[model samples]
Target: MKVAVIGCGLIGKRRSQTAMEHPLSELAIVVDINPAAAEAVAAQYGCESATDWKAAIAHPDIDIVAVATHNGLLAEIAIAALQAGKHVLIEKPMGRNLAEALKMAEAAKAANRILKIGFNHRYHPALAKAYDLFQAGAIGEIINIRARYGHGGRPGYENEWRGNPELAGGGELTDQGVHIADLIHWFAGLPTEAFAYLQTAIWPIQPLEDNGFGLFRFGDGAIASFHTSWTQWKNLFSFEIYGQKGSLTIEGLGKSYGIERLTIAYRKPEGGVPDLEDLVFDLPDTSWELEWQDFIEAIAAKTPYWGAPEEGVSAMRMLDALYRSAKAGAPIHV
Candidate 1:
């Protein structure tokens, strides 16, 4: 399969490299609005470079189109690629909002093409193991979940694309918050209701918040809460789930987030300390490679895969409710 990466940013470079290394796909072209960025990435991988993404998408030999552009362009490029008879791997949050995501999903369905969302976090080693254990009842019947994820904003961040409402959609809520929402949904399924509070805090990006606090209520009576911030001086990632029989705690994400670790605590019937098992994943992050492999395997086998469009839509749906709740200052059904 020939792949064209349309967007020469940090993520686009990662996707291009993955496509180049994967045996099932070849990096055929790189495209960006800035010709220099596309040329640089193309030169790095010895592939063709172009400023026109549409031409790249329309190329007869390109079978996969990786859309890693800004949130505003995600839906447009993805729909076009799908209509061009190419499978697409789009970056997360799916789009700026739920409506755009739905349109992209519809295009994929109409074109009968695979549309994978970029949710590499699900491929993390510790999270993957935790998921396996949860599925096997390591944590019986999830009762509640708590997660916190964020990083301090860099200087001049207010001027970046993410700080712009039109380019990035909702602020921290749609940025890292989407990942938290997706993980929550992955573990306990979509929530029945959502409530949220947003704050600009330190960043000058008004309208677009620098911090977001959200709560969710599940249909099974399970509840989840998370706080994503851009003012947390230190990088952090923590997700803890408590179940009837045991609890699973995932902390860090390697590197700046600290060593990725999972702590499993089984409840004791006698009211004493429960059995404790701690596991650490010290390997370098290979989530991008693993995610790409999953996409390729699914394409080759014509089977269902992770990061499915519906999963993206569900996550976006949760985000939409949270945004609405933030605006109305009340809980909203998801």
Candidate 2:
């Protein structure tokens, strides 16, 4: 498979590496608005470079396109690529808002091409194991989920593109909150209702909240409470799922977040001490590679992609409701 990665930033570089390393794939081109950035990555991957995303998407040699641009451009680029008959792997928060996301989904369906959203957190080893355990009834029927993900901003972060509402859509919620929201939906299905509170306490970014806290209630009475922030002094990622019979806690995400680990505890039937098991992974991050491979295999087999456009739409819907609820100060139905 020949791949064109549009946007030569960190995520694009990771996508390029995965494409180059995959036995069935080759990095054909790297495209970025900044020619120098595109050229640098192209040279490193031994591929062509283009400043125009249009040229990359229209290239006949490109079989797949990875859209790693900012949240605002994701829909336009992904829709264009799908319309051009190329499978697409778009970054998270699929679009700036629900309308754009819905349009992307419509385009994918109309084009009959595979469209996947990059929710790489799902592929993390610890999270993957937790999912398996959940499916295996290790925790029985899930009752609720609690997740918190955050990072401390560096100096001058307020001047970055992410601080601009036009480019980033929202603040930490649209950034890291989307990941946690997607995971919530993935594990317990879409929420029936959502309530949220957004705050712009620390960062001087205009009209964008640096902190977002939300509660989502699922149809089966399963609730998920999530918090995403840019004010965390220490980067952290923690998710806990409680089931009728037990619970699972996923902590850390390797590197600065500490060693990735998943702990499972079963409730004692006799009201004694519960049993506990801890699983640790000290390996390198392979989420980007695994997610890319899933997209590739889905295209090859003509199967439904795991993180398909519909899933993106669902996540965006939840986000939209959360934002609305925050504005209205009331719970909004999904």
**TM-score against native, each model:** 0.99, 0.98
Model 1 regions lying over 4 Å from their true place = none
Q: What are the clash counts of all predictions, listed in order?
A: 0, 0
Q: What is the Cα-based TM-score of model 1?
A: 0.99
Q: Over the stretch 56-164, how does candidate 2's per-residue lDDT look in tens digits?
A: 8998989999999888789899999999999999999889999998999999899989999999999999999999999999889889999999998766767887998
TM-score, candidate 2, is 0.98
**Considering every candidate listed, which one attains the maximal lDDT?**
1
Residues 139-245 of candidate 1 have per-residue lDDT tens digits of: 79999999999999887877889988889988999999999999999999989999999999898998999999999999999999999999988999999999999
- After the best TM-score superposition of candidate 2, give how far the Cα of residue 235 lies from its true spot, in angstroms: 0.5
Error of 1 at 190 (Å): 1.4
- Model 1 lDDT, residue 322, Cα: 94
Q: lDDT (0-100) at residue 189 of candidate 2?
A: 89
For candidate 2, list the clashing residue pairs, or say none. none
lDDT of 2 at 302: 79
